[model samples]
Target: MNNNIKTILITGGAGFIGSNLCEHFLNKGFNVRVLDNFATGHRHNIAPFNNNHNFQLLEGDIRNLKNCHQAVEGVDYVLHQAALGSVPRSINDPITTNDVNVSGFLNMLVASRDAKVKRFVYAASSSTYGDSESLPKVEDVIGKPLSPYAITKYVNELYADIFSKTYGLETIGLRYFNVFGRKQDPTGAYAAVIPKFVIQLMKHESPVINGTGDYSRDFTYIDNVIQMNELAMTTSNQKALNTVYNTAVGDRTNLNELLNYLKEFLAEYDANIGNVEIIHGPNRAGDIPHSLASINKAKILLGYKPTHKIREGLREAVSWYWSNLK
Candidate 1:
């Protein structure tokens, strides 16, 4: 694809991951278009690109089919990232989550199909591996969903598969494993563990670890995710067109170890951060005991190579948060 002429539409482009994608593609000189309703995304995230000639922002919601259609107009590729995240949030209000994640995803898919876009790459979730006792999750192997959020993501994959077979629309689903990095929101009920812990430790507050801090996760970095998206969108391999890939670093870190890394990183800014106490609580509902991914498929198919491991990613994330959020 020609970097200067290709137009990529990123839905929810003001959100954490989406905004990073916008920045990356824009810097590469691709015509980057952003569609966001500011429901869960912030305007400040995209403020830096306001003056860029290659950047365009469309304030809209994916729940509306017209908005989706409008966003995809004249676009070459679609990076569908808009969704209501958080398993607990979905449990509390399944209807709203369904309306946005499931229905909104359908709208975007329909729009992309109508537009005849080159590829439709979307954000799937690791939560789809719910209730499965497997240690390392592979693409073809999955269990029943444990939460409404997981169900929505699984339905997205199902819908994308049907679209590919029935309408000949090329699509790829990326099952992300606990992605974290710069611009991740830390002040919300649905805040992810890494950013939340960083915020708490910065304030010298006791960071709570659910379930004895033994539960582990395959923490992926944002740069690695960007690489996966780029490869998914640009790959010419016929076998990789209509399947899912595990977008992860293929390693696990427990909450205890994660906290230790956070403290050590943050202590460079404030010595008191290393002295903060950690509290343990009961395990969260709809949360699995452990999660790891097999990235061999991605490596073989899309040439995916992770740039940062957990500790390295954590250090960079800490520096960003300290510089921006502190």
Candidate 2:
């Protein structure tokens, strides 16, 4: 154990975002430890890091207090990314969603508090905006939760605030938008729109749009998310601690446009992909008509300058999926 190098404990470290964090920190010479139960995350995602001396994996669940505590031991910072995501999944099984996203989050807070970890940065959600009609969602102006998953993530913010105020634990929550990129699984039932669409288009299959194809999102890229997590963990400004920031690109693209972008990118690799038709499905329940983020707060507070917007991020994501999934 090198006393000089900081140790970061990233829960859900085998997932798309978490594994990326592991790679980033390890490359920067930080000791990275992961705690995951392999529920939703894949082993192949973190397999590359297994041989790195600075990387450690603790196969456990955040729902377990003992596991949380063990994970926090000797850790300087904690990035809590372990949560049951997807609004539809939460609607279908609210109980399991609450158990992991809320109960499990509480356990992590308690563990980090007791461990006296320097900072606790978590993966919050843009879904917390709920029914708010705000064009660019500011952090404070949110409406009622639209789904079970939104409630759980909102509860996480409340618990984190309480932990910060009551126990003096430093915490930061990043309300991530539609984040997608390399290593994001496209086969899952709750797969994110971008990766799913990319994979579908690559196979010359028609991608389905949930709504009338007008609903838009602030589709954030994985590298931007990784940057936010790093900033949240390392910022020295006292005012930056114990608050939530919207992790997004401050831009919105509708489902129809999103599909077109996928087609344009994928067609470059396989020209026939451009001819693939699109299928429109019924509007998904618990989905907001439009979602866009005001990243000004994150920019002002954490110095977050998104390196990739929709087209730039999507182009790279499509390339990665074509290479890896093909």
Candidate 3:
């Protein structure tokens, strides 16, 4: 094991983003501990790290205070990524979403405070932007939440702020845009757009767009998300703490453009994928028409510079899906 000062605790470490964090931190030679209940996370995601001596797993839920305490034991940094995602899922089951996203988040915050960890970094959401018609979303300016999921995420920021001021718990909230890449699950009702489209195209089925495909998003890559987390966890700038920053590519891609990119990339593996048709559907209930992030805060505060643009990220992500799912 490589010598490192920090023992990182990544909650929801079996999920796509959390699992990627585990892989990255483990590779960096930090002692890594994972806390996951396997609710939405897959065992296969963390299966590779089982053999690493520096890796430890605490099968537990953040919803339980005792489990949160146990998970934070001896951990230096808390990358709190555990939460029930999906706006539609939250819409259908607001009660469960509140239980996990809000209550569960509070439990982790309390545990991390008691444990006195160096930092508590968490996954916030761009959905917090809600009905706001801003071109590039800034952290401080947000509109009323449109869904239960957005409410939960916004509440998380409030709780984190209170924790920082009241308990002196160092915290940073990463408001992620449409983050997509390898390890993102394509199966399930609430699967993200990129992976879902990739799977559909690979199967020679027409991928459906949520609206007329004019709605846009700042489609952030997973590596950029990881970079923000690392900087948020390790940065020396005190001004960067206890606040949220947009973790995104500072660029937007409409649904039509996104579909075209997916087809263009996936067709490299299967020629017929390029010819697949796209179907349009009704706009989702909790969705906004556009989302783009202003990553200026992250750039100035944490020195964050995204390594991958939309096409670069899509090409790489498509390659991964082709290699693993094919």
Candidate 4:
């Protein structure tokens, strides 16, 4: 198989991050196949790629081992992005999140092992840091997960580790920190900040600010996330394999700063829209006060470098949401 182009199976490829992955790989000349049930992922996300000869879409759920088997069968690598993702959503129904994020993850790992794929790269979350107050989160040190969603992602790292040792499966996990950008669904209650803010502002509606707006995050962009996934999947370095790396720009932006930033970006679209207000609400359950990532390891090992910071990212995100949603 040519190293530059190989068949890649990306789970949840119709979802926000997954769809981005599909587009990225197809652009790079790789044969891309997607496994998604369209539960949370929308068909419109992948509509642009439907006619591409290099892209193949499979209508299946990761919960089904048969689907996992088929998806893993002719792939050189596996980018396992499928999961039930949101802390609040997990709080509302822990069992369903656990079933999909945990159980379904296992199904993908097992199937990938059986297929003898080159590498298994999956999405891990910064939520894994949980209550850890460390300014810049290091990969080795971690605190107990505060939410079921965090627990699921942390478990993915654990399973990836165990699988590497026990089953000799090569795995790498990318711990995403507040990733946001194009194709993010703002309609969902569990939608991430950037998209939700963009949509609400576009509709001349008030955006909710959970807590005192002091809560901060190392908001990552989608393009950076795609670079991380690709680097993890293609790395040949022994030290880079069988571990997790923090995928972020290593900069922190508080909710207040982010809100103002979004508003400023939106006002460029319509000056009158600048008056949109923010409603303060109580802090959410299982939310960490601050989040920042230490990306020293990923940079050294995988040659991973994040290209976009919050401002540059929000510009792209806000513009896409405006053009696409409105």
Candidate 5:
């Protein structure tokens, strides 16, 4: 990878995945700039990087074209991670979700295109699979969206495709499947299962499992996602550009298995976490029963070999929460 490509713009840089990307690229000596409105992102997530001379923060919203344009200026690459994330949140407020995920995504695309960014790498979602029952989801196969959030993400892919074809902009979409790891927020109504479960167990509270606990997901680690972004940004492969790839480990784990692992890891810090009873709840409206990714496309196209599997990543994440949030 050429270190000469100095500047990188990460949208939603104050958020979990985006903050991680900011740190990774900043450590690599790239001039990293962040555009975030702090709507769902936290100030503390980016506080440590404020002192870094190479880090610049554009406290703005992607919903505004001026903010997107300001963030993309002089940036070689754009990692679009800003969006209203949660299926249920979108269910309650589809309009807001569509505005940010769909409209804001278009704004970023137009800004990056006009700026002549070297590459635009954006976060796509596994929910786009929707009602498709196929196990181990492939990039091409998709069903009708089950929720407004899914529709918005699918629209993002569509816009990216049209932008690439019509405007000659290089873009790559990463359909992230339940990404979890360090800096992931475990609070609020829409928090992801892993982090939310970790927080519950840490507090010795009964972690509620949506559905029968048999439903599974390909819970990807944040590090794997970060690697995918870097590869997508820097890859010289002509075929790899302007296409979507599964950014996840090619594996699946059910809620039952997930809780067991969370207990095993968290019990290291507090043995009582093992006694935390798992509670059952109704299945979430937009959630699929099972989600597993076929990483063959990522491996062949971008040479992506995930460093951490579920257990390893969970252990690391547990340790972080215990040390920092406990």
Candidate 6:
């Protein structure tokens, strides 16, 4: 391992973010391995990388200690992005969410520590700011978790901090705020807003906007997420080494605004989608009203700069849906 070309492991490398991470590291001439059970992830996401010489896939579940142990061997860095996402999904079955999000995360931390990985970068969530009515959410000031999923993501940060202090393991947490981009699955019941809306409009079906359509989010693009992971992995500052960073552009887009943007953007692909009127649904349980992230720390500390805002990201996403879904 030439240090920079050292082998790294991405836990959910078959899912949208994980697969993109794998592709990114591979392009940078790194040796990458993926451990995924294909539970919520799809094999097709990694299909394009199957022929790449620097890539390997181990079909295993993270819920099993043995599998997590096997994946960590000789891994220089671990990007732990595997988790059961969705606030409503967690509310519906918190036990399963805890099993994967919390317990499974512990397993990975221990395994990575034993394997002597250089850095452990994991996915944290913006939901951890639940009910904290602060604008431009920061990393330190957080409120009570409003959902089971929020609790799990908050726990990830807590455990990562503890691991750094007691166990001498290096950790960095990226608090993703509504990430969406290419290869993000759109068929799942708990599918995220962007993909769900894109697919719905593509099919001439009305996309449901939850609530009065005023809830806003800092919709981050996958490329920006990749930038955050790469920066976190390479940061040298002592303060930046063991902390969490908000991985988003400092902006927000409301659901109704999102609907109009989607319709306008998608019309360039299919003229029919230009006219689809989205229906409003009742407010979802465990759902937060507004979400926005302040990326100043990530910029000043990690030298992290996000390339895509909501509109630019959505344009790319809409193009992907138009071609892939059709």
lDDT of 2 by residue, 92-188 (tens): 9999999999999999999999999999999999989999997889999999999999999999999999999999999999999999999998987
lDDT of 6 by residue, 1-326 (tens): 34456898999999999999998999899999999988889999999988888889999878899999999998989999999999989989999999999999999999999998999999999999998999889999899999999999999999999999999999999999999999999997889988988888888999888889998899999999999999999888888988999999889999999889999998987788888877998999878889999999999999988899999999998888778888
Cα TM-score of candidate 5: 0.98
> In terms of lDDT, which candidate is stronger, 1 or 3?
1
Candidate 6 displacement at residue 1 in angstroms: 9.6
Number of clashing pairs per prediction, in order: 0, 0, 0, 0, 0, 0
Is candidate 2 or 4 superior in TM-score?
2
TM-score of the candidate numbered 6? 0.98
Tens-digit lDDT track of model 1 for 1-326: 34549999999999999999999998988999999999889999999999998899999999999999999989999999999999999999999999999999999999999999989999999999998888799998899999999999999999999999999999999999999999999988999999999999999999989889999999999999999999999999999899999999999999999999999999999999999999998899999999999999999999999999999999999999999998
TM-score of each: 0.98, 0.99, 0.98, 0.97, 0.98, 0.98
Higher-ranked by lDDT: 4 or 5: 5
Candidate 2 Cα errors over 4 Å, as ranges = none
* lDDT for each residue of candidate 3 in 1-326, tens digit (9 for 90 to 100): 33455799999999999999999999988999999999999999999999999999999988899999999988899999999999999999999999999999999999999999999999999999998897889988899999999999999999999999999999999999999999999999999989999999999999989889999999988999999999999999999898999999999999999999999888888889999999999888989999999999999999999999999999999999999999
Residue pairs with clashing backbones, model 3: none
lDDT of each: 0.95, 0.93, 0.94, 0.91, 0.93, 0.92
Task: Name the lDDT of candidate 6.
Answer: 0.92
Identify the candidate with maximal lDDT. Answer: 1
Error of 1 at 215 (Å): 0.3
Runs off by more than 4 Å, candidate 5: 1-5
What TM-score does candidate 3 reach?
A: 0.98
Report the poorest 10 consecutive residues by lDDT, candidate 3.
1-10
* Full-model lDDT, candidate 4: 0.91
